[model samples]
Target: MSSDAPVGARPPAGKTFFGHPRALSTLFLTEMWERFSFYGMRAILVLYLTAAVADGGLDLGESSANAVYGTYNAMVYLMALPGGWVADRLIGARRSVLWGGVVIAAGHYVMAIPTGWSVFAGMALIVLGTGLLKPNISTMVGDLYERDSPRRDAGFSIFYMGINLGAFIAPLITGFLGERINWHLGFGAAAVGMTFGVLQYVLGRRNLGDAGARPADPLLGADRRRALTRIGVATVILLAVLLVLLVAGWFTVDTVVNLLTVVTVLVTVGYFARILTDREISGTERSRMKAYVWLFLFAASFWLIYDQAGSVLNIFAADRTDRSLGGFTFPASWLQSVNPILIIIGAPLAAALWLKLGHRVSTPTKFAVGLVLNGLSFVLMAAAAQAAVGGDLVSPLWLVAVYAIQVAGELSLSPVGLSATTKLAPVKYASQMLGLWFLATAVGDAIGGQVARLADTWSQPVYFLTFGLASVVLGLAAVMFTRQIRHLMAGIH
Candidate 1:
């Protein structure tokens, strides 16, 4: 029953969602509930990991928990590369999204089981599912408009709002359920959210005219058989290696995390090498790709600090922040809601600001702004950590202010980076470029997870200040290279 129209074909002129295609509403809601499930579980993951065993938790140490959080995130994003490949060469974006949603829902339901092993098993499934779902859905969003359509950015802006709205609401509900009630129940709620997403996506498929109807580049006959065989062999080899490690007693959590971090970095280097050395791309495109490398580093740096909201900062919120209001103490996870709400409020304003500024401001300059603001947020966190030195609880407002600043930085860089990725991508690698963008986050979270171990060994103030200042210095350095980067960008704005 799926439409077989070519990709990017406009939907039949009928009812619309805010003057765009009706299908946008479908994709928007699907992404919204998917994010709801994601952020809901994320709000409580670290807290659940580090809580007392008596409190129905794993009771993992702080450093280990943070490391797990970072690795899990890295894996989720890292999978995007293969996920994109699958969509392009096998199932197409439409089916990938549907199957991904089902797997995600199943993963959350698995976590709802009250067992020590279930959480890790559930996280593995979610990582695979998210890998399939995330990038393809965004690709579908892009497919809704023709290339170079003015409405393309506006459509993505609306879609971005959906993401924030879900994120804004999820922590409030899941934080209360997980922290004040049973952690499993919170996971169950996330499962329900994803189920709703899946059901609605199925129901709304008709609205999607031809967007992601089939693979962009399908492998045929012998090629398909060969590809499947190779995938099977690789999976078997990976499993065999893991089994050997487990049998040899070297299959520790930290070891696995460290190994994956290295793998993520190597993959990034390889991907960049493949793109840069491709003889097919024109000189102008190659120049733009070179500029993209700088932006990628800037984005990776931004996420390294920004993504800690769910790990290191989440722990600080639980242990050091005062959540008491009148007679009742609020859950620490509730504070995680701050950044998204601010994003929801600030995104439009930032968009308008960018529109007004027009070509006067370059992408590198915007990225530098994001980097500086991200560092300043951490610098502020350093002060907050210092205040909590003697076991004194700081006001919840400190975290709020921190998240607000981070949101501003996110606004400055994230959307800009996405736009830049599309603009700079070589024509042949267009579909895979989004996956490369996600890899930046994978690199940051992977390395940042390792870096976060320092928090366990160093004073809180020192830890925050060190990374904070380092980011600020990197941002300033980026500013110095702005003109050079723009020159490398060739004609891209």
Candidate 2:
């Protein structure tokens, strides 16, 4: 059978990775290392930004640093759309993954250069590379299994573990190296991680069979040329705009961040408008799309708060929390490991709980639960901030408890949101649905970055409490509208 053939249609498998195809191991490890580098760098990004110049840091104020962090995250996710397009139209997923890895490694290496400009330049490259790798790698994983196979979900679950494992370990190592030694050395560690991932991926190429070897839909002949031309033109226009901004003295970091955030929001709005106004969509699909709008808003809100772990929270750990451990002060970034570890321990339980609940619980209700949980996490954070007032160092347990609650919220909403995105996708726009799902994150991160600016100006407790209460109120509103949203879902659970 062809490599594209379903698992059930193929002859009995000879060797397998954990009773599945061997290719899974390759994908798993690749993802694990990619995440290791990604999270490792993220753990220290803000801390590096806000660090003193004497300590080989940028000395960006907290507000600008938070904005930069948010904008960077938003860009990483936003790039996935164009990244997916490039894979589909120009290169196959396999080559995209390969090239993306190469670029990512280069980006990390650039960050290791110990120059002020190098970090920003390196971040730009990483954003581009991650856009290429992130969405396409997940696509390749899906290619390993047939659409309807029961093993497909199982494969993804295994893949998910790899992601969490990487995330769980990255901070401990990178945080220690970055915080105790030079920040650039910590970045170098991340580079090594990505390099290992790339090397192993190349070595394991044989196991991949034909998965992602070719584009699902390739632009041919004139179409390909036209697409390339458009890309080139867009790049030129973007560069021109940057030149104008710089020459006009409007090219500050905050200005760039705010501009990108606006762009992300506009893209999301435009995408939804296109889908909703399409004449081709059936009424049923339209209703479901409408329901998805609500879900999308809820998800965006969740991530706005959840993803702040690296930025606002990281700063909090550094400035407010006591890290001293018997004359050995721990790196603040080490605390980042808490979320993924909790997720690793809690995921199976969450999965089992959802399985047990079955159809009795609706997606909207789960999302509502997530929102409330997320709000409560921040509410708890409010107390933590309150304790840290008057320069009193609070216990690290405060952040731990907060991350635990956020992880619970993540467990409830994230996977459910993915499933719902697939279910609610109109048949005509099926592939684009995943892009839309990612957009929700991009939108949230972009706006959240802006929202985080308030952290620098407002009292920490008030800031946490205001957002926390707002989220809780939104969750309660979601509870009130569950029936309406469900009816609009057109029977999709």
Candidate 3:
């Protein structure tokens, strides 16, 4: 799928905005609006559920709310596997993203109806839509560059900025609408944001050109057909097993959650094992791949905490923080902007730090540092929880502090981890490798949702403390293992 055309391969021959192509602007705005819809809806979901039944919520208990939240977050990430596959094998990335946006917009609109089943259905559609949009958009960014282009990292950074910008603004807009008028109104606002993104993508289709091209059909030849048959057989066997488990009363929601977690972990481990066992892999490559696996686990742990921005953090801000400013109490939904707002402020400083220290530290080392920073953010949150003891309002500054620190950790780790993944992936399985990375995040977010649901009758302080200690311990352990990883990444960069 290498393009002979030089259209988006270079910097568009001679444009002058940071020396990048204008198509970057189109993609940036599109991603911004998409994230606006996502983060905005996420900001209100838990609050809506737990908001007294008198206030029109289904009034789900803590565990149930958290369970649903976990399942929804987890499934969103899982669906990305099929989403990426469809983009690679069926429709191109552009089309997949466009259709995905439509699906998500509908989901949000359904959510605005304020019904129980509609909430479930809306969440499902949003999950599926995100699965379609998230992976394809990033892949399209990579497509904007030719192989070995230096601008790729910078382009991704710019794109990441778009993510924060949307995330930063979404809470302010939707949170206000939700808390002040009706929660459904906020959901409606998110739908409007997604609608704008879909329209932008349509208008900018020419700018995208053939960035997301479909691969040749794998079912065309007999050899491919046989391979596909084996895959289908395996799928059938797995489904049959699941059905048996459900009938046997072993497939409760908890069981399904555990099963999904186990299956995803096993598959990821198997992929790594295969790579390591293969004699074809050079020793250096093996070392680096091992490092990549460690980074994966580290990232998984970090997100297990970080993804709480939606579930746990939302409740904390709503219940504990002093939303009162002068005469009026601010909407709790506005607190959802904390993470993204911090990212917007801190990302530039972070980008500058990387540039300054690029030669001093390896990517794996940066990841190690990032995990520690992320762990520290939780510690700060625990302190906030401690301060909020005995039903008194704690300062919102504590929340702000936690967000700032976590954003720092995100800057250090996320992009670098993705960069490392690309470098270490075997050439033949590049797309699959990226899929696995995204999948790990899905697993982590699902776990975060579960953690978020623990607020019912549990002391929120204890929860934050437990999570904080766990993250710090894991971060330190990852740092201790950094030498081996450094050896792995020695030649890749």
Candidate 4:
């Protein structure tokens, strides 16, 4: 994408961003900073909310805090649908990415102020900013490489590391400031992170020449005005409904959770129906769509379980897991770093294992195995819960091992799912299919919020064991039907 170079020329002959294009350095650093800000805030949001008001918190209570946290996560992903649409149509991904960074930085600064109401404003801005930035920035990463370029996978792997790196370090930096020093300081740190990202991106973007500089489908002037008008009407209708609910005294945490759950189900069903009924697809494409539906089911199930790491598991780490290291106690948010650390260590090993086994295994078989591993992680957690006899503190290794194993499950299914989506989706609906993939995560996350509520109602053993059994049963079912699903894939493997 370098503007100064001739077409097809490689990034300047000198040092590259880890042997890839120089454009990668810009996008990589930008994403790293964005993720740092995002995860840093999430690390302590619930804790800050539940703390006493005198301690610089809103005192929202545990249930309410969890509700807000879960809903915020769900909304972040949900907004991506429209964000991607906007980037693809009205605005180029390039400008959208830049403006989104500004919005996200503003959001962080908003949270840094010392006021309770500021939290809502901050979250709203962050959600909107993230929706605009997250997916589009990722799209830019692919622009750094040419189609069939051998360096493409390696470039992405490097980009993936940047993501985990930010996630790994965010809690460490913000958790200390937010939990130990001051809450606003923590948020301010996140603001600083984004500021750094934005400044660097402004300086380095020339390497990414025309990549994402133009919208794939640009809108006409009247069409743009009509789109804005429709958006305005939708926003008014949404606000009116919320106002009515508030006036009726029905705007509670449970209400939001329940509403999102129903909405998620509707969205999931609608996506599947849209693809299956598309008359433009060939017979083979239709069969592959069926396979994709099955893939969505398994992917959603894994996400429902995996998404708990940042929510329910976070709470458990704070309240139940012992954070002491021989008289020195650490921040509970430190535990969030474990999975990324595991990913850093395990990603290469997992990739190697897959490469070695590729000739011997099928993608569906690998997915089924991933599902089974996810089930086992829960089973281990269930046992850990059972072993908390007489309220004794369980070893931190219990949580560590569970997180480690969950990463294994993620490695097995997640990358395969991404590849499969591109391979199996009808060409006409390429980007939509990717959006649908993101939607699966949103649905899982919304349902996860509902499931997290059970922490208050059910015994630990009961909750863990039940979910564990469900996961295992689902995995077994996937295993049994692997061949059927693979057949539907119609040579995609």
Model 3 Cα displacement at 351 (Å)?
2.1
lDDT of each structure? 0.90, 0.91, 0.76, 0.82
Residue 235 deviation, candidate 2, in Å?
Answer: 0.5
Better of 2 and 3 by lDDT: 2
- List, residue by residue over 1-493, the lDDT tens digit for candidate 3: 2111223333333343366766777788889999999889888887887777777677766566665666677777777887777666666677788889999999999998977668877887898898888888877777777766888778878898899999989989998888778888999999999999989888876666456644323234676577568769988998898899979999755676667666656666776788778887677667777777778888887888887767777778888888889988988878778888777777788878888877678776777777788778877887888888888888788888888888888988887777678788765555577777776787687667666666665677778877787777777777777667677676765
Best-fitting candidate, scored by TM-score: 2
Better of 1 and 3 by TM-score: 1
Q: Kindly state the number of residue pairs that clash in model 3.
A: 1
* Per-model TM values vs. the true structure: 0.96, 0.97, 0.87, 0.93
Q: Which ten contiguous residues of candidate 3 have the minimum total lDDT?
A: 1-10
Candidate number with the higher lDDT (2 or 4): 2
Worst 10 contiguous positions by lDDT, candidate 2: 1-10
Q: Which residue ranges in model 3 land beyond 4 Å of their true spot?
A: 1-19, 148-151, 216-263, 277-280, 453-458
Candidate 3 residue-wise lDDT at 127: 82
Where model 2 places Cα greater than 4 Å from the true spot, the runs are 1-14
Instruction: For candidate 4, write residues 247-285 as lDDT tens digits.
Output: 999987668667866876787798788878989988899
